[model samples]
Target: MTPYTPPTQDQLLAISVNAGIEELTQSEKFAHAESDLVEAIVEGVGQFAAGEFAPLNRIGDLEGAKLENGVVRLPDGFKEAYDAYVEQGWNAIASPEEFGGQGLPFTLSCNVLENLGAANMAFNLLPMLSVGAIEALEHHGSKDQQTKYLPDLVSGKWSGTMNLTEPAAGSDVGALRSTAVPIEEGEHAGKYKIAGQKIYITWGEHELAENIIHLVLARLPDAPKGSRGISLFLVPKYHVNDDGSLGNRNDLRCVSLEHKLGINASPTCVMSYGDNDECIGELVGQENRGLLAMFTMMNNARINVGNQGAHIAERATQQALYYAMDRVQSARAGAPDKTPVAIIEHPDVRRMILRMKALTEGVRALLYYCAGQVDRGTIGDGDAKNRAEILVPLVKAWGTDTGVEVTGIGIQIHGGMGFVEETGAAQHWRDSRIAPIYEGTNGIQAADLVTRKLGIEGGEAMIALFDEIARDAAEQPTLLALAKDCAHIVRWMRDEASLDDRLAGSVPFCTMAAVAVAGWQLLKQDKAVSAGAAPALAESKPVSVRFFLDHIVPEAHGLKASAIAGADLLYTLPSDKLVAG
Candidate 1:
């Protein structure tokens, strides 16, 4: 077994920037997030990872979570750690300043979240939900509503949940059956009584905080059918008074918690509203526009899910590297028979390890770059905003899909040990599985990319993205050739390719776009590296950027070809031929 040496800070920075991460910090819109701010966030995240969060990960999994008397109880030390998290004001990173938040860039907030996810995913979910609620409220909530609820949520004195999925409506919010009836002029005149069941609510019921604010979607009594009737609401577990203190428990109650395959520490609950005739909800935005309002939160949440995937990949890679270095195996081909070599010495093992490292770092770069885009879109000038909007779907879809693959490789690198639950490798694999499935699944994300984002502003935004990629690629001949190939493929896939044909190769089309986008981002980093940027951060830029372009970018070719191959083979297969009689 060989001693393990952590990658240097400079090396990480170089690889990250080469991956297009530092651009997030340097962008003019994010100028406020100076080096000192980044350092502070990094330091805080590092401390949380090392001291509070990482140590309790195994404990949380081992004990799991329990539902007793309608309340979810976390494993030992979970509450204390959560409190410590709040005490550090980690939850307020992205919240507005008026709401007792730091109002920092999402890029910085995302960096902190990545570390937290890497440390303990279950623990991180509570605050993640709260942030989502905050976004929805900030964007669409009435001024009165925001003033009343935003402070506690931002301060982490309370938590939040999004209630969308039900037994009948998981992916299709339009199929939702929840009802919201306006109250007669009485004690709750301005409110509506919500009656419905929402399933799979993360952090649905927990003892982690004093209250839970639920952002629910329900149809009004006189509303039209389908999604047109749907509306967003703020339903709390406990009502608050004019003074902002907690009041009586609301009508929402957790019937029970789900026993899940993974993320066992984060309570997934079945919530029952209006069971006792007391679930009062405040309408958000206009009636029948709930889904639109929810999109604000969902979009942000989708990106966060991508971050989850990236974080898990990073952790899994670190674990695999550690195991590879320590696990003694057969001697290398050239080594003496008497001496055993570390598994990392095996050519195949090294290859797997390198793939894991490359994928993890590459996805991290993508996630950070996406976060930077988000920051720019929110704070930058008009041009930056346009670019950021164009990149959203690409970031959401590609980051998550790649994350799953990277984590899977992490598991494979562990071999037999990977399958065993005790090794914790399998847990990462299981945890990552859900990212692509939820948050507007990768297929949906791809459809959004091609159908919406590509054509945004008459395709100008996508054109801009391509121009940037081309400009960056011109600096390196190898990458330029690859970029040209990708551009050619994208054009063909969009214009020449048939929808029915592409639908058969839907997965491949998505994969192709992901590959091209990743290559483009890496090329951007390569350009940054050549410009003699931060030395420490530019170190890994050349090698990683080249590795991705040479080895990974070629995948776009296969995907593009498959996408153009037509759907006849898939759709033509008779129903009888597809299944055994």
Candidate 2:
């Protein structure tokens, strides 16, 4: 399992700029990321990924993590690789500088995580969850809590987990039944004891680090029912002293690990809290406001899940392309009869490869653009913040769903080799299946797009996005042709007579909106390239953008029609009518 050596600077410069490293380097927005810092981080991740991480991916899956005597042990090499990650300062990419973080731009964090995911997704779960925990603490933890926990978490000296789902509550947190009772008279009077079970917790219990901090959501006594009653707590595997050193072990224990379809190397645990009546957790933020506090982390985790999709898709696409180039088959129409040609020479194969490339690059562009917006919101003043906030969900929903589709195509390109586990194409396909399911399902994402994101500011945000696309199309003739297609769709969507049509096509309409928005960003890159920014990059921006607009964007019409058609066809049939009974 040799790690793919990343393209050199000059070689990278020659690749397509729709979402290449060269363009990322040249973008004006990334100017804040110091050149030395970027180079060091990228090189470190590249080497670690190729040398240590990638080799262990399959091995980890085969061996898997194990639970013994209430202690969860990670697969071999995981501890060493994790230590290397911490030593390289990879975990601090997006944390605050004052709290032991490097305070780098979110875009850089996205880039680093992409490589880590590509190299080994299962092992990367530890840091991913740690960062999510760090974000939750940064946004809601008290100054004392931040001072005590931020350093260790950011430094990767400890790991973290978000315990949300339960046996009864999966997508709906409102149904959660975990409870927290305050201690009366003790050394930890302000702390509460958490008691309940949480399911589907990733990195829930592992011996990868010194400690594990669980961000548990539970109900307090005398509180209201449902979501309003829930509160967040910082429950640790090993209690921490006032000075932040590890203390006595807590009562939290991993009851069992889930048998998952993919990401088998990353242990998903069933954890029980206060099983021994000694689990003390400090409350985060106000009681009954835990849901609000958890949203910050959920949103962050959702975006990362989307990136998981994007990163895996990129890896799969690369694998497919490599196989297509090397696996020779029957000669094509123009070739000599007895000779064999690479699969890449066939028209259908080329179409599939091109489709994979276009979709992967398109999603990459969307995610990177969204990453830039996040950076701006964090560092740029005023309006930049507003813009970045608007783009978050779109990036999350579109990026991840596209990842699933692209990875599936990656398998298609590999043919029968993909179905066999040995080729690893099936692994990508299996691993990527969870992206859309977790971090909020794709259907939920679509609902949010329609109900919350699209209607923000009374639909002004969406209108503005449409206007920006129109303006871009107007300025560039090549884009104008594609924009014209988008404009037609938009016009139809807005027409009073087309309301039913639009509603019927809501899903497709949303899909079109995604492509239109993605194309808008791609066009900006085209403008940048035309202006001599990253001049050495290949000029596939127009071709790729056009391909999406021409072939993919039209799905909007059908989707919009279906969305507007109402749920009649779906819901009208009674249960009895639907079945033989």
Q: Best by TM-score, which number? A: 1
Please, what is the whole-model Cα lDDT of each candidate in the order they appear?
0.75, 0.74
Q: What's model 2's lDDT at 461? A: 57
The lDDT of model 1 is 0.75
What is candidate 2's TM-score against the reference?
0.90
Candidate 1 off by > 4 Å: 1-31, 336-338, 475-482, 493-498, 524-541
TM-score of each candidate? 0.92, 0.90
**Each candidate's clash count:** 3, 17
With a 3 Å backbone cut-off (N, CA, C), the pairs that clash in candidate 1 are: 13-537, 14-537, 501-567
Model 1 per-residue lDDT tens digits across residues 1-581: 11112233522453345323355556554456665666667766766765787777777777888987777888788889889888989989878988898877777677767778878777778888888899999999989999999999998889999999999987888999999999989899989999999998999988889899999999998888888889999999889999988899998888988887777788888999999777899999999999999989998888788778777777777888888888898889886675888989999888877776666666666666666667657754566666656556666677777767877887787889888878888877777777777778888877676666656676566655665666766765554555555556456656776766545555665565555556766566566657875466566667766777767766655565676677777767788898976
